[model samples]
Target: MYLIAIAWMYVVVMMTIAEAASPGGTLLGAFFTLVLYGLLPLSILLYILGTPARKRRIKARQAQEAPAEGHPPSGTSSGVAPDARSQPPAAAQTDSVSPVREES
Candidate 1:
């Protein structure tokens, strides 16, 4: 993906140079060609194409920072530690705000 972007930028740079060297082409035209034809579209394309990679990087970093199974991070859990508890909480002792209904 990056290789493609680099190749494209190289092409655009050459095109910009050709534009600047042309008899009728102005420096302003070259600058506009570089920016409008090269930088803008390439930036948007790379960002869109790199979405999955960015997401993967984020997930990988989070996974590395995440605590191991059965071991919660410090100061994040409320009350007693999950491993320290010997029994489950009562069914009625839920934190749900919605009322339960019985089936007919």
Candidate 2:
């Protein structure tokens, strides 16, 4: 990758030099040509090339994490404590509340 970047830099430098030397081309035109034709396309190409590797790395990291997450601490089998685990769900407490009647 470094070699490719260095080679591209050399190509751009040579192009800019040639443009500047040409009777019809200005230094400003050379700068724009290097930015528009050279750097922009190279940047897009590098991004497209790197995307799959980036996604693979992310998936590999997630896969590594999944196993670690599967097993819990020895002290706690479930996320809740032993005492809390014995209790019924909070939603079951609705029996103790009186329902409100709507007034028209």
Residue 11 lDDT, candidate 1, scale 0-100? 97
lDDT (tens digit, per residue) of candidate 2 on 17-53:
8998999999899998789868997898789878999
The C-alpha lDDT values of all candidates are 0.82, 0.77
For residue 48, give model 1's deviation from the true position in Å: 1.0
Q: How far is candidate 2 from the true structure (C-alpha RMSD, Å)?
A: 8.3
Highest TM-score model number = 1
Residues 1-65 of candidate 1: C-alpha lDDT, one tens digit per residue: 98999999999999999999999999999999999999999999999999999999997876677
Candidate 1 RMSD computed on C-alpha atoms after optimal superposition onto the true structure: 7.3
Q: What are the runs in model 2 whose C-alpha is more than 4 Å off?
A: 1-5, 71-104
Clash pairs of candidate 1?
none
RMSD of each: 7.3, 8.3
What TM-score fits each model?
0.64, 0.55
